[model samples]
Target chain A: MSIKLTILEQMTQVAREQGRTLAPLRDDLALLDSGLDSLGIAVLVARLEDRLGTDPFTNSEDVHFPVTLGDFVKAYENGAP
Target chain B: MALPEALSLRRHVAETQADRFLFDRAARIRIADLVRGTSLDGDPTALHGRSVLIATASQLTSALTLIELDGNARRLTILPPDIDGAHLGALIADAGIDAVVTDGETPHGLHDIPLHVACMPKVVPIDRGRPEHVRTEWVLLTSGTTGVPKMVVHSLTSLTAAIAPRADSDPLVWGTFYDIRRYGGLQIFLRAMLGGASLVLSSAGEPVAEHLLRLARHGVTHLSGTPSHWRRALMASAIGSISPRYVRLSGEIADQAILDNLRAAFPQAAIGHAYASTEAGVGFAVDDGLAGFPASYLEGGCGATEIKIVEGSLRMRSAALAARYAGARGASLRDSDGFVDTGDMVERRGDRYFFVGRKGGIINIGGLKVHPEEIEAVITRHPQVRMCLVRSRSSPVTGALVVADVVLKPTCVREEGRAQVKDEILELCRGALARHKVPASIAFVPELAVAATGKLARLS
Candidate 1:
């Protein structure tokens, strides 16, 4: 599966577990504002790190918290082995 | 009555039992040698009444120089060697530091003051200037839960009031996971010195297994670490071979499972966990093979310290409280009765009170509150689980939901066994925790990252 698809799937799974239904995933959607709060972002980051085998947020010296879905996917893509 | 000078204790130890102080990796350093090597005997007038910052990278050198400076009447502030240049500048400005004594390169923007490294042995005779002792202050930085590290002011008297003098013959080889700059680590460092016991310093940047091996080689009988540190050390194969006489846990809540595991591992060791903070100083230690102190300790049973529960949180009053928070404009740390709110939530479990979690970290889950530590304790009880972290996950329906990240034991890494272990962990949580407390999701990680202070990095 594509990394972006896997990210969306994990987000959906986390949203469903939290008993909230998320809208269809889009690249420009603001993660912090898109129904998921800081905690949700944290869970999503952890899930992505597990599936993708790398955590971009921790790898960089100057970590930029991903504001949108595209930036979040880019972090994983940039850090991919 | 005026308190005894901080250096006087060291002098007495050096005079009587010079051969028994610290056991570094390469050699056993005596108190007499430490005093002679670091003492400012050449120009006492230069450092008199000056505020000094001790920021050495080596724990042994830091401890030695801290004692030397404090003994010489130089006001002292301890900064971790790895403190960022900006943070160091801020701390120096906040504390109004005059001079810094360090082995590391002086940070930029602070090139005005004198930086003294560990000096070679000087043969000048010790001069006893007038018997009057200067009022000295030891400033320590708070762990900075609020992102701004507050400087806590303490006197040598207040810091050492609880430590009882130990006989010279008592055999003690101390080891600690905390850096000497931290309040928890300072307690062990001071305790070892006060007792004239030998201590094995754990060097920073070394592997846990290697440090444990060094301690074992030095015959470390008394050891202390945070629960997370202990869990990691337990995972290390070298830990089983090291026999400690006294095991202590601090820096985080000591759950029952860790305590039980330690007790089972070292049956002869006296297991104790202390609840102490930078502002609160040393509170109390529970030696019983339980998670929390007995309920009776709240009523002045724990020496000079007094404990009370206010608004479901623990508050304490003691002679050992930090004098005041530095640079805090008119901020009061205590109430009229001298009780400082600890900001830690406690739940009464029958006769004992157990720490639920920090008040600030409480997860509000659709009107039900859950503490991540409680969930972590339950999750960590599984034999296959090496370490676990529990945190709140944001939810649209509920304000937050419980989530966990677990690190399994190495033996449980088989693909088929991993699935079964996860199921078993979920089952264990369901049986042990409340419905809302059970984690909604559990992610397995290879290893958990630990902070520089040797604590599990919590999601902030």
Candidate 2:
């Protein structure tokens, strides 16, 4: 699966497991308001780390924490290479 | 009022019922015979008034040596099975050990001790002549959060202050999953010795199933282990083989889930969980089938032990508390008022107080302190979850993030709704815990590693 699809699927799965309904997985949607709290985002990052074999958040010291769905996926894609 | 003469362990053994026995996996020896015989191949008088270290490979041999040397030696330091090898030199120097006792080959790092005595399981019946008047100082090691373990000093009176001799004439067989060298197991050993009860002991490498079968074979009337030890026992198929009349738990926070599960497993047993530590002696035990003790325990006093809470940590003051820390690295064991500060943290809820976790075990998430045990208590409440470990995983976003490793019941593991079970557990955490305390992810594990201390191995 593409990075975007994997992130979106994990986000939905995390949200559903937490008994929360996701509004949408649009690129422009604010990550904070997309029906998941910081805990959900943290879980998503951890799950993504398991699937992709790397954690973009921990790959670099000065890397920014992504703010939206698009930035989250891009962070992984850019850090992948 | 006249002060009674202090009694040593050998004298206590001489006075107890003659039929009591202490059994390990391989051999069973009558308690009375232990005092009549000696495991030391060397002259017993050579060890008198010398600081001796009992560093044996077998718990049974250690027990035999302790029985022989308690009053004879000037100082006897118990060396636990799980002590790290690197700390031995410091320990020997710290305790001022002059003589060494061993079962087989001398334990590594103790070659330089002045006197080396070889001990074997087989007892030799020799007249170990006259008793001495010196009150022996007993030294026990406590595992600190970092560095070498501190040597906690105690006398026979302090160690056995909480143990009350049983009045019943029936043969009460006691068994425990803890090594007798540690404080918890030592208490059980002392109780069995002084109360005229037979004890079934645990070895270093014995499997849980085999231990349960042995306990069953001996017909263990009273059994004790940590909550972690009991959880592992409950998972074993041989759990139904033993029917202990009394069950006790200590050495860790006994949560409601474990207490309730033990009650279901042994409905006939009077289940209780006690609070004790290497430094504080034994504080109290709650036998009303509850997780924590009543809030009244913190009032004026409970029995002979006075309980007080200073800054959310439990502090106990009693004759049972250790006298002081030994060695040059030793510090004052008690506070200004002679209270031993047990590092366990408890929170008051209504008329009772519950242990949250160790004060040193808190995980920092986004600068907020979270106790992993609080989350574990919530996760293990689910019927499908057998046991769980809540730990902190380093996170880039927040300094650290919480995660859980869960072991499901045998039946539930083969069930179809694994994802659904995970969902329910996460939902349970979401409802009961704060956002930060909720585990960011959960992983299903077949089993969790228990430490040599009979507690969960929470390795960072």
Candidate 3:
């Protein structure tokens, strides 16, 4: 069994497409290791939503997810609808 | 039952910049004296016998400002700022103020104290046969939300219609989360003055729960609270404490949760929310605080209000409307219907409408719409963080990104260096926010700038 489109993998794809290098935020979180700030997060979410056809920036979910560097990255990939 | 003599009201007409003004109404009058004029030591029982009603200078300017004359078939609006004493003196000489009520506040530049005045209590009776519309009666100023205070002229008929149904005169005690000087406050104070109700003013930062208990102690039945005030009440609210008999929420959105809380707080009380503006008065359909405003924009049977949702915004046509703004006439947000467009954004879920946020507060980062209030709500959920500002700043690549400035909760302040709290606050935000929504920078400020009037300057 394998996880297709894990949070880290998706974040990497989006960051790469934008021509920006995402420095490793953590080995465990994989892609979200970049520790992008608020503006960075907003830009990434908007771009991710455009590419994946889902909302990554909603008020309700943002209140709960992204507690850890890895958790935030995972939530983005898993949470988008 | 004889009404209290102190409950009687009077008016004074003063020249702008004059320490002295003419009292329009005389002192207290007996039933027998009602037929006659100025029976109390030759003084009319109009001015409510108060030596002076201290108010802000702008209030005095509103009084001498303009007046409407009844002699003309139509409303003769004469309410203009007396502006200067020279102009007021000329008007006094012109016999123009035959019947005028002075604004409660003394005019501008009148630092002199021990203000003396009398009234024309008999003037209304003398002119009783004249229609109220034809008679010059009341005056008001705009809410000053748009930066400049404007004079919104109104007659007793227009102003009273908006407030009569909502007034708590039968019991006399009214509780609300509005400034006494604002429109909501004006209605309450005017009713309190007219009905002999005790005015209970709340001090800042006092838990609203305590205030509710005080109102209950005074046998208060009516209640009101704004959005921010409601949020504070939510913060201060315990499971079951003080319950009001009737609650009114206004000045912002009233959703189902708010309605539920008010209902729970005041189980038997009728809860109502209203849609009104300074220009529109208390116009629009009566909201039960249970649903979005009426599905149809325009509603009748509520009062003299006409309401409509134009282009996702609420616009209203009101007979209780104010005449005009006082200062320089700034850009008008008035729609084609002459209905002013209040900048609130509304969404329709079936027949129910929900308010999202203000249109002006909407932040567009590269055309992606984000409401700062939405983001701030998320940040506030973290216990370690208190209030937070989620705003967008110019960025070269992403167009813009959300940046946050936050204050640590009092409990978060520890003896360990500030670094610990900062780290905790940052950790909390990072966990809560998404990649795009996380603050690029979360700086702790000693305190956010709060206005003297008690509203946050989000844009400023």
Candidate 4:
């Protein structure tokens, strides 16, 4: 499976588990406004680390914080060793 | 009557009130018979005035051996079961152990001792020899880092200094989830022995349910263990089987959540948490059903022990403190003015001081220092959470990241709603803890491993 699909699947699962309905999974959708708080983002990153075997945030020192779904997916894909 | 220079366990047994028994899982021996019967093989007089080590497999025999050898041996070292076998040689040489006592096989590296007396758990009736009146030094091993444990020297006088004889204590039965070789459990053992109360000893590998059943069978009115031990007992179905009047927690931070949970579980019991260490002796016990001790304890001489906060670390001074670290451990157990530095760090809020964590147990996140226990105390406050262990995981972004493994209350275990509960717990942490201290992720665990010391298995 592609990293984008896996991230979306986990994000949907995490959102559903948290009893939050996700809006459409668009590239421009702001992650903070997509029914997931900082904690949810953290849980997502952890789950992604487990499923994808890479944590983009920990991969590099100068990596920018992802603000949108596209940026989040790009970080993981580019950071994958 | 004035207390003697050295209050021997043998002399205490002779003076104890009649009709008290010490119960292990398999056997119960009347305290009087302990003084009358012999568990030591061959001539017991051969051990008189020699340094000895009590390294028994079972706590019962250790207790039995301790009572017999206290005054007879010039020095008695109570070795806890969890001590690394590799350190035994150095420990033997350090303690000047000329003789060793064991219930079963002799401990490795100590077989060459001049006297290796085999002890039996059950005492046999034999004409007891004359009691030795010599003052014996009681040496207790302090939990240490990877090296051999530090041996703290104490006489019977210093050990029993905190135990005050009660008028109505004869009918009470005492029990503990600690191995009597450790300082915490040894305190309970000494209290029962000196106060003439029957004691229920906990054996290694005994399940919580079985231990509770034995405690119930023995009518344990006062029970003591670490907060981790109590957390496991609270989860056991057999917890409802025992109704103790006094419940005590020590050896770990007793947060308000655990105190409240214990109060809810046994409403009729008086719950308290004490501050003590192998070196500090008995600091003080807080019985107000609160987490930390009252700030008033920091004032001049609260009870027998004096408490002072020196640079955020708790320091105590009292007659109950150990004499000094035995052998050439280099560092003195106390400062120049006679204060044992209990490495527990505490923060004062309002009128009470709460334990943050150990001085050495801190984790560095990015550049900020965080105590795992400080976060655990917050996460455990959630209604659905029973217990939690916060630890550090290596991360490239932040050097180290905080994570938690939590055990939810049995009643609140709903698989479908676990994610919701996790979110709520995160929110709880976010509200109370700092941004960096908040756990990055929380995993639900069925149980947490507790060490032989009755503390959370932090290293594991």
Candidate 5:
């Protein structure tokens, strides 16, 4: 239960902070490799920099970046500064 | 030798090779015992030859070699740029020769080059040389266009010698047939020519729709491209177009969807793409994907070969190696066992190898090896930048300078307080990165300048 909530908490906080109260879980937690267009990715990158306190990345044509909130957090921990 | 030495005329090397040997696909025109006194056609009296610049795909090394051995001509073959739309003038001026043998003209943006006064290009020939003897050596130019391009020369003997043994793979192999001008295109050309398969030439400057039109018209059994190329081609097919007998991806990785797409497109045409280099010589192992993407490999003893990763760079022994960089100091590139270091970085995965970025792609910022993609990723994170490019430029104190060319987000209006976005971006990188990894300079352009096909141009 604790692990599952820890995983769910980031999305919960992002939704509350952005005032996007009822947005679907799948939309908020999309992966980097999947097919998000340019504008959608820009929003995700901005939110990541704000939440993670790490500098956001330049845009890429290659990967979509990670989608799941847990996956994004993990990538945040491991990614270069 | 009865051959017309190059100091005479400037044209196809075939014209100069009077008595030595003749190699067109499988049509052998060797100088027989009684034919030693003859000269090849175009035996010009003014052997103070016109200059010729050759530009065929890398796999045409066999034809190139046949030219080198038979015709005593001084031909200048220009190198292809890594990201496309690069200049051939510096290369032209460096060599001081005439006439060029290049892939068709479109990829080169040939007319933009006004300085190229002596430029003459020969398209990749669609004919075949005889089975026993090899004919041309297609020289390959590396991606870096800043200095004289790294020349990977291959010869006719080395190119054609591997034909018979590998020919059995036939219509079953995944990548043996593609456009002869593409890096992998030339490989397929050589494979098909050596194996006795018919060559189907593609129409120049055609879109995916046009490509499928040609494919249907020519009854094309096989198709090949980079990952991006494969994706676009496959997407185009969804609208009901390109259906080849075979499908393969080279020049880049084939991920999960790419593999699935190939299997779906040419269920009967063997599906595969080989990871090869001009230095490594084609013919490597086929990988089964574990991650979202599959890796590549070259089998043990595929040819007279050996592989090494010295200081994290890939090197190989290709019997079909070309001799020297045309105008550089005349030094040979043979190793102790005659294997050349390919300069590609690789990681071992069981018995296979995966491709990484180039060694030169590593930007050394304050004694750090920072991949440009890493920095570019951060810049892209700013919801305001649309596209980004990272490259090393001139630096006085630090050996090389890092510069970023960026296209801002569509909503970010260019006028009235837009300049603050640059500072915000610099501040963002300053917070997340070390001092050096931050770009020394940044250029905010309207749009990123890329080729017609979507490859990023690193060098101007």
Candidate 6:
């Protein structure tokens, strides 16, 4: 599975746990404005680590935090082996 | 001025106000009988000036024998009875131990000095002169994060410097959740002796409810435990029945939630939490029913200790600092000005400074830092969490993510109830914490294992 899809699925799981429903994902979607909060982002990161076996954010000394869904997915792609 | 001639434990026992100084469930031992029992070993003169390892299973026996050995001027290293045999041998060799005293069968290849042999009735009229004024060193084992326990050396006088002198007619029955081998437990053991108060020793492998009932039966007025121990005991139905005058929390970060819960549970108890480590010796304590000490304490407001913050980590220097780490030659314990970096990260909030967590334990989420303790404090405030351990989970995108293992209240056991409880906890975190600080995932645990020192076992 793609890291981006895995991240989205985990975020959806977090939303469902909180009893919230998220709309279908899009590249231009503002992640912070989504039903997921900062904690949701954190949970998404953890889920992605489990699926991909490496955390790009921790590996890279200097990496920018993603604001939009496209950038978030790109961050995972760049961190992938 | 030479350390006030090192107060002898034999003299202290002789002058104790309490007739019954210790209760070990099996018997109520009087101080006089304890003083007289030292003669059963014939003469400890040969054992004097030797380094002895006392690894007795019984707390009372260890305390009694420690007094006798210390009075006879023997350097002592008190090890927990359950210590691994290989590790024990290594420690013995490292500390240059010449003899050992045990209540049980002695381990092979170690010279056994029979201190318990004297506990029985023997007609040996051995007079070991008046308690000598000599420096007696105590080596304590620290349960370091790296798994290798460090031997911390301290003198008996330095260990008891904070203990107040015995007062007239003060009948304080002391109780503690820690085993006597640990530094936290030894403080309470010494405190009770120094104040001439009776101690209700909690035996190892006993249930919290059972210990609380025993303490209540003994009319224990002073009690101490780590915050994790207190939270577990608070869940017990028997907790509300015992009323203590003095309550202390140590060996762990005493969060505001635990402090507030303790305050509500024991309104009359003077709730205080102390900060002390094996190498750091005894630090200051906060008693205002608050999470942390006042910011004013940083500028030498806490007795003779000088406290400072070096890049977010708390550092301390005091007269009670350990002389040196045993077996580690010429290792610098303190900086040039004598301040020891405590490794505990502290943050200033208005007028108070709160311990966030250990510097090494912080979780970094995509460049954002979050303290696991801060998340734990929030989750435990929900009233359903009996105890919780927050740790980091590696993330592909973020550097690390927060995860927690929670032990819920007994009533919230059913699958349906647990689900609802988890949801409620998530909502609580959403409201009470930043998004990054909330745990990414939480697994409900049947029980959390507490370290021998009574603190929650930090999951690596």
Question: Which candidate number maximizes DockQ?
Answer: 2
Evaluated at residue B379, the lDDT of candidate 5 is 75
- Per-residue lDDT for B1-460 in model 5, tens only? 1111221111222332233322222233332211222221222112223344444433233233223322333343434334343446555554554544333343353443322221111223222222222223334555444554655555534544333443343442223223444345555555544443444433334466665654554445556665545544544543245456656566543434456545656665566555565545563434343211222224444435455557766666655455545445324666777666665565565655555456767876436566665567567667566557778754322445466888765578856545788777777777776656677557787655444222345563
- The C-alpha stretches of model 2 lying farther than 4 A from their native spots are A15-37, B1-5
lDDT ranking, high to low: 2, 4, 6, 1, 3, 5
Q: In what order do the candidates fall by TM-score, top score first?
A: 2, 4, 6, 1, 3, 5
Every model's DockQ, to 2 decimals? 0.06, 0.53, 0.10, 0.22, 0.03, 0.30
| Per-residue alpha-carbon lDDT of candidate 2 for residues B339-454, written as tens digits (9 for 90 to 100) | 99998999998999899988889999878788899999999999988899999998776778899999999988555577888878888988998878888888899999998888
Q: Cα miss at B281, model 1 (Å)?
A: 1.1
Alpha carbon lDDT of residue B295, candidate 1?
Answer: 92
Q: Compose the digit string of candidate 6's lDDT tens values, residues B1-460.
A: 1135455776666775536568766657676665545632546665677787876668877887777777565578988755656566668777888777666566654544433233222223455565445567899887664544778888877677656565556688999988878889999988887777888888888888998899989999999999988988988998977999999999889988889888889888899999998778778888899998899998778986789999999888877788787884426778888888888999998999998888887778878888888888888888878889988776644657788899987878789988888878878887988767777777899888887778788877
Docking class of 2: medium
TM-score, candidate number 2? 0.96
lDDT score of residue A15 within candidate 6: 81
The sequence of per-residue lDDT tens digits that candidate 3 reaches over residues B232-314 is 55445441454556667677555555566556656787888776666677765344656456565444544456666777776
Candidate 4, what DockQ? 0.22
Off by over 4 Å in 3: A1-81, B1-139, B143-147, B164-172, B190-199, B202-213, B234-241, B255-257, B285-288, B297-304, B327-336, B374-400, B403-459
Q: Is candidate 1 or candidate 2 better by lDDT?
A: 2
Off by over 4 Å in 4: A5-47, A55-81, B1-3
Worst 10 residues of 6 chain B by lDDT: B115-124
Could you tell me the lDDT of residue B402 within candidate 4? 84
lDDT of 4 by residue, B1-460 (tens): 1248666686678776667888898888888876677778867788899999998899988898888888788999999998898988888888999988988877677778888888887778778668557788999998775687899998877887788768774488999999989999999999888877899999788889999999998888999999999999999999999999999999999999999999999999999898889998988888999999889888863688888899899999988899988887737788878899999999999988999999999988767898999999999899888888999877644567789999998887677789889889988886887777878778999999788898988862
Better candidate number, 2 or 5, judged by DockQ: 2
Point to the candidate with the largest TM-score: 2
Residue-wise C-alpha lDDT for candidate 1, range B1-460, written one tens digit per residue: 1247535544645654655656555445566665444444345445667788776657776676665656555578888655656666667777777876655565565676664443222223465453345567888887753455778888877787667665446678889988878888898888887776777877878888998899998888899989989989988999987999899999899998899888888999999999898888888888888997789988778887899999989998887788887764326888888888889889898989999899888888778888899899888889888889998866533657788889987888788888888878878887887767878678899889888777788777
Interface RMSD values, listed in order for every candidate? 7.5, 1.8, 9.7, 4.6, 14.4, 3.8
